[model samples]
Target: MRFPHVRRGKAEEPPGIVGVARVDLRTKVLVRRLEPGDIAVIDHADLDRVSADELIACRVAAVVNAAKSVTGRYPNLGPRLLLEAGIPLIDDVGAEVLSRIADGATVRLDKDVLYNARDQVLAKGVLMTEETLDAAMEDANAGVPTQIDSFAANTLEFLRRERDMLTHGIDVPRLTTRMLDKHVLVVVRGYRYREDLRALRPYIREYRPVLLAVDAGADALLEAGYRPHVIIGDMDSVSDEALQVGAELVVHAYPDGRAPGMGRLRGLGLDGVSLPAPGTSEDVALLVADACGASLIAVVGTHWTLEEFLDKGRPGMASTFLTHLRVGSKLVNARGVHQLYQSRISGWALAALMIAAAVTIGVAIAYSPTGPILGNWISATWHTFAYWFTGLFK
Candidate 1:
């Protein structure tokens, strides 16, 4: 089949890029199995930074996205990161290409066209360039005011819907961990979570707070050498291995009582309970702690800033804002706590401090009238030790 080249301008062609196609409807799931030198076939719209970071870490040869990489909704950093990493990005290739191309099929990306081993053009897409991406980012920045207005509207709508649940309390599921009058650490797999977890090591060791992981945060906890006391989320991002680790699993269901993730758990023969809620899983986790009467709830890796909420690409963050307000006095962001709390002194520093104190004491003794008495005592002790040594020899 003959395919027309949709070249935009007279620009230099990108270098040879060829690899096996790894196709998945969900970018998050696809990233788990992606390897270096493989072309990722994804259907992600306005690809977020976290997904892009995962793709970059996989070292993919190129990305063939079936949807628009940037819709000018917000200045998402995903496409920019891929381009900065020297990875070719082909956007808006259409959903038909996903069917035309088979998984594990060796394909060559020549300019903006993709060809199979038989030299048949499978699909064509716009190859993103630095100039084009920069222009799109500028446009996205200009649209920030509109996005913020929309976000505020959504937040108000959420407040109206979930006011009672947030203010009163959620009917929390029974769990093995008792949070009553205790400190609870709720970890979410969001911004700088690993670094925050590293910093919280001393606190975790000292308090032994209930380790509550939200979705993939379970994996994060396990990696940090702590088992989760409760695992709550939609159960999509978390691994089956983490599910089987014996933590109580609570699936976040829609307000209308629909639980989609329960099928996956039943398929794996794992037991879990469903908790109907309107907000994100992290929000539900905080509510669960609050309902369980936790004295203090420390949060790690949860979104706080407006930019972070935008990065999430979801309007439901209005629920997050309300969740914070409801959990008020009890909720403390772990990021801030980590920054303020001073860690225990190291052994080397402690030893050096002790040495300094001993030297100061010795100097004070030498200058005071007690110097002669100390000198005589030291001499007598030395002679006694010397006599003991001589007697042993004899």
Candidate 2:
């Protein structure tokens, strides 16, 4: 049920937002290639906050979603985040939108309709605004109990299935990189990771903790000019350059021993250790560090709240819940570590203070009763020194 603008041989195109369309069913994959001012076409339902944050960072002109942005599913915060950022969001456009609008094709979006370069309508959807998103969020909040029930069921099922591993310990792989009694920084490419990592720079420089990166988190570390000591995850999002950085690779796999990352490592002629576990890569990373005798584990970009766990949209989140229970004694958020331990004063601060003191003293002396006399003497001393130095050079 799309409305087409059928004005033929128009002198000027319709007034609307114009940009190249980047279409993908997976929002995460699409965001990587999207440039600022491009229109993002995604099929994400109940769009999570993490995905919305990425889309916002890309500075997209508009978002056209093939699926409903919100389905009263646990009050997801993605649509609201987009609206707050002033990015136009068109919701519930049919899946046909993906096929109708070609990727990398120039398109124009009016209030609710998307038009191709020829000014023909491709798809139409409900435009999401602050008012509509707020109404949806309220209704969605009513559905949280159902989601919580589902979450509880999944958590119970996971606990039943993974009780032994959770109680005893994961069969961690051996590594050349040591963690015994050392502070371990487990970096995940999750919520506000960049800001938290930037804040932790002083702590990172001072402590020099073992950097454990999960998939794309390795790239984040490298971007911040730090080499990861260990990289662990399914081989999907991490780059080839990160793989070749000589970090000890640990391929986390299914408990049944299906290691997808191992094949990728082999293809690159690289060796890796495999640790098959029940939970997420982050969970496995934390547990592995604890088992290896880490003094403390500081995590960056980890999901901590119920909304965050729901945003993750995975049954494996139940395993992460259990993982938290197991590692609660020593586990701490990176922001928490940055807040608790005050970094020592730097030499730069000292130098700046010294310079300020010198300037204040000179100003006070220059305004004193002997100001003119001191100024003349200083000028004469400088002139004499310069002449003496020049004579020696001659």
Candidate 3:
């Protein structure tokens, strides 16, 4: 409630179904107790990290959400868990609200509907509404697929910018020799990118791209079966293990000539190159790859949405924009390049699944009073055959 956010009142904006409330931000409620019918806005993506277990344990009449749940880019049955426990599930108030409201903002519901806190109410309208609930369900259904496409497109744009930034031409920074024989994997600290990388690890080892970690991405790369070729950042999130991994270090210095990572590298007895680039760790990593003439820079676990940056509580979006613009042409996301990279299930895996299904069906049918065991077995076996036949990848 002590946090500052713009305030608007219900009188300022009408209370009916003015618009869809989609909650994507999930954060801890600083208030004492959420009343039975009071509508609350949750907006942090890592609710598990940001929210207290007690807040989640609260049984409310209804709840509105704002962030993607842990179950991928979609809203899982998490909010519904409370609802099924007797609380009603309401809308997912999307990024639009975060762009509008702030911490400790007071809002009015109806006659007895004044929801107040020490914080300024950033929301101008009523929280719980039938229209808002419907919108949350609709968004929950659509959020996952939309997120996947957005991730893919942002990755593509990042690669292209990287290629361009490399050729930007700086003659003063000749402290290192540049070569392009190896491929590059540009890493960023994105949510579940490590899992995504784990799912696709085999392919990464296959390509054997020069692993370039952008701060926290160094740990991610190591976890996903790759040694980093270079660690690039301001020495903030890159771990101690990642620091001395024998990878060449590049300290991204401020334009003011302060190289933060240099001191860390020096203490570790590691040599590092400094690049005076003004942007994010990811951006600096891309620039290093370009300057070194790294061929084919691929990206993983990168931030793709504006809301993502806001979740980090950053004051600006300049670094993200600049990084994308710099590495737009040459980046490809982790596709089915893992063993499953774009490959459909083989007849063997499908046949295995079908057989697994048929055995259970036969067991169930044998116990059915109306079932002809012989006929049921035959039908199930046929389905298994047909499924395998259709599922076979040519």
Candidate 4:
């Protein structure tokens, strides 16, 4: 093994940010391989907040996108996050860049230009900064009305198509892990999931809610020292180790009954039941909890706001919105649970009760026939302890 400080007469690096180039057409799949100081070359257009957050977490030195990072589509939060994180973003570098640059190749990102290890120029594109991001956001803000209209149309279409399921809840598969009358915690690796999970630790410990992990959210639960009762998703992002942790896997399928996840599970010699649904995995998980007769459904790392809905970059968010309405009073955001759900026994009350008990015991000891004997025993014990403590110094 080589140590950094032990190396002698090392050559000076190139003039710009130098790192290995990790390229992929799918941003989400690509993020898993990303390591610190690696340059991420993706073909993502109008990158969403979740994908951007993943890239930021990977600590990629720079991001080179084949498509526009913000195509003025509802003010995408990805580019802004990357900029804020001080990760250099080269926008709209074109698809040729993906083909030209091989994965694992050492590349240098100098301003807007990308160069190979041999210092050969590969591609050049606009380097996004605060000014460019702001301008693009301004244009995106102007286009929000059009996006909102489109979103509304999609929502109505979804509601019309899934009217039966939304009205009466989706047909949930029978499982050994019962959720009836119990608080079910549905976890998704979305907005503020880590922070929200940290906040919900007390609630989780107190209630011992049924932990239901959605895809990669299973890994999150495992990281937080939790084992999910059931795992639901398309089975694309979750780790194999998480799948083998004795959790029941429910693969979310398309409305037409095409379950892609089953193929993956079968390939791994694992068994899972399929639940054909219309919306995203997050939506399906919520519906499952509601349909399973859960008393309360607490969600962690799930979207709640209009901005979060837009940030998802999916038309199926309409289904999520409808799912919340269907779940009604049963659905509660885990973030707010701490404020809403208060324990019956408070620390102050318990402390006061203990103090009262002590006072009553003291009074009884003073009035009782054996009170003098008890008092003498207590006083002698205290005197012995005090003497032993002081004698240590001598």
- Model 1: colliding residue pairs: none
Rank ordering of all candidates by TM-score, starting from the highest: 2, 4, 1, 3
Q: Where's the lowest-lDDT run of ten residues in candidate 2? A: 1-10
User: Using alpha carbons, what is the TM-score of model 3?
Assistant: 0.46
* Residue-wise C-alpha lDDT for candidate 3, range 1-394, written one tens digit per residue: 1222345732233341111222224233231234433445565443331132223444333344454333234543344444335543333345566666444344433321223333233333224334544566566556656754655565556546444444572323453434476678777756546556776556566877777788767876776667777777888667778888787777778867889778887887888778776557776666666666766677776665554543443432345655665567665666334544544788899999999999998788778786696777788999999999989965
Q: Judged by TM-score relative to the true structure, which candidate is superior, 1 or 4?
A: 4
lDDT of 2 by residue, 215-239 (tens): 8889889988899999999978888
Candidate 4's residue-wise lDDT over 1-394, tens digit each? 1112223677555567888999999887798789998999999988888889899989999999999999987898889999999999999999999999999998888999998867789999999999999999999999888888988999999989889988888888889999989999999987667777887888899999999999999988988889998999999999888999999999999888999899999998899999998888988998999888899999998888887888777798988888888887898887665456667998999999999999999999999999999999999999999999999999
How does residue 138 of candidate 1 score in lDDT? 93
Top TM-score model? 2
How big is the positional error of residue 86 in model 4, measured in Å on the Cα after superposition?
1.1
lDDT of 1: 0.88
Worst 10 residues of 1 by lDDT: 1-10
- In order, candidate lDDTs are 0.88, 0.89, 0.56, 0.89
The model with the greater lDDT, 2 or 3, is 2
